[model samples]
Target: MHPQQQLALALLAYAAQRGLAVDRLARQSGLDTAALLSPTHGPLSAKQWHDLWLNAAQLARDPTFGLHFGEAATPAALGVVGQLVQSSRTVGEALTHGAALLPLLTDQVWLDLAHSPQSVWLRFRQLPTELAASATVVDHLVDFVLAFVLHELDGLLLERLQPRTVRFPPGARQLPEHLRVLRAATLAAGPPGEYSVELAGACWSMPLLTADYELQAALLQKITQWQAARPAVEPLRDKIAGYLLANAYLGIPSLEELAANFSTSARSLQRKLQAEGTNYQEVADAVRKSLALHYLKMGAYPIKEISYLMGYNELSAFSRAFKRWTGHSPAHYQPASASRSLPG
Candidate 1:
């Protein structure tokens, strides 16, 4: 879930553009604004990135901040991935290349591109279900991508470009004026899984003004060299925790599925968890408890919705588990101090 520094700086810059209190937002997010202002910073975890998004929007009182931020993004603002995309031969090639390059940006999210008869659908979803708590961030993601694609191909078209349609999760807020500035874009709420942007076929195949193969080759080699030196293996417990957190919304994966995901067998996975001083159920419950406490403390959704989000069919079932996990039901867990923890 490590994201490049530019991702964080984008929000901060947006806040500054609107004249919000940068110091206060930094303090609220537990980020050091001074360090972040430097050109030399490292990657941020999924939670830290989310904190930046939430803090900026909250402090700015600008829910459509991401749209502006995305609209203003340049190759420099997005880092090497953006630069690589600009060097692609055509807008279609950029989309394909972007799908591959997205992993270089962040490992905690998924950027899936699906093609239809007359359009290309770009959908983004957070890998960790816990990260989906704030739907406002989804707005930023969709707006950002839409603006990004338009920027790359803006010269190919005679006029400004816009997505054919934009679909967001059930809970995200929309601002038509944001999209109206470039061109008309149909915006609507759909399912609660991913944020999507639908680009017409004509726009997809349009040529880019800045295509260059030699530069792209050099960047690709640099990226490949970096990947070649990654850690040979990751900790078994961390892998399990990440998997559990990501899938907890659908339902914790069965031990068999979990093992299969990691190319191991169920018994082997169980033994590994034991070697790490924990078991599968313990890991699953711990993840659920963590997400539950997060939502309860945020106090954004109702108890029933929180239960459904945590993968429970009945609120009573979630209440029972909360009682067992924290010696209190959802009602009493409102006090931030009432929330407890389990080893992650």
Candidate 2:
């Protein structure tokens, strides 16, 4: 199943275990229980998914409520990597291996890494998917990847963990309950949209999760060897992303402009993109979606400024596009209470 469905199931299971009514939670999150249960249709919208996760967290009083969704089952693609992780020498090595193995599971996502002398920022990248429900899939993947690795590392279940910041905003009257679960001091005011966890490199040794050493090492090595021969699609996607990064939010380029930049005719470009399982519009949308999050995280630019930069002639146009991208309005996307850091 896609990560989003897996995530929704995970949240449903957690709520059931906690003795909370799933229907009630669904209602609170503005979800239709029947629709959520429909497997034939695509995933829920980004906002709908976030609202459900947020509602579940509030009801369970656990920030990690969303994280636990992956533990219930191992995805087919993640099996080998899961073994490698289930078996690594240390938490750091395991995570490093897992990060490298991420592409094997899905090239649609990328992990963002910010390494410093004192701290290491391990951020999950949510690549733009053409599917409307792709945002939820991205969200669930972030939770799943982190929770799965942490669980194997600690060799124990972590009921108390929470993201330092939730990707979506916290619901009203929910912070106290969430605080009870996370038990971590939150930053006062920070970036508007990006969700992050700031941890010291030393914290890697803190034993968030535990596992067997030899088996994990063998698994890691196997994954390493397997990845060596495997085709890496991210490089190609990044090439496309690199092209868009230069003109982020300016406006969508014409088919000719895009094809020229890539050094090919429009027909050839279309064919190549189709072969790559994406197209011009998909790539352009992905670029803008990514830029939206990156700029939003900076918190310096106003919503209108970001909208314009994103190539929206008016804020409303940007808002509509953003909603389609993130399932939340630009104004409503940024968390109000969290402390934001300035871009360096």
Put down candidate 2 lDDT per residue, 63-176, tens digits, no spaces: 444444433223222445655654455445556667777765555456665645565556665556553324444455555565454434323222223334433322212234
Q: For each candidate, give its TM-score against the true structure.
A: 0.54, 0.36
Best by lDDT: 1
- Tens digit of per-residue lDDT, candidate 1, span 58-136: 6766566566555545455567777677677777788888888776665545788777668887888766654553566
lDDT of 2: 0.52
Instruction: Identify the candidate with maximal TM-score.
Output: 1
Q: What C-alpha lDDT, on a 0 to 100 scale, does residue 266 get in candidate 1?
A: 88
Where does candidate 1 have its weakest 10-residue lDDT segment? 211-220
TM-score (C-alpha) between model 1 and the true structure: 0.54
Provide the global lDDT of candidate 1 against the true structure: 0.63
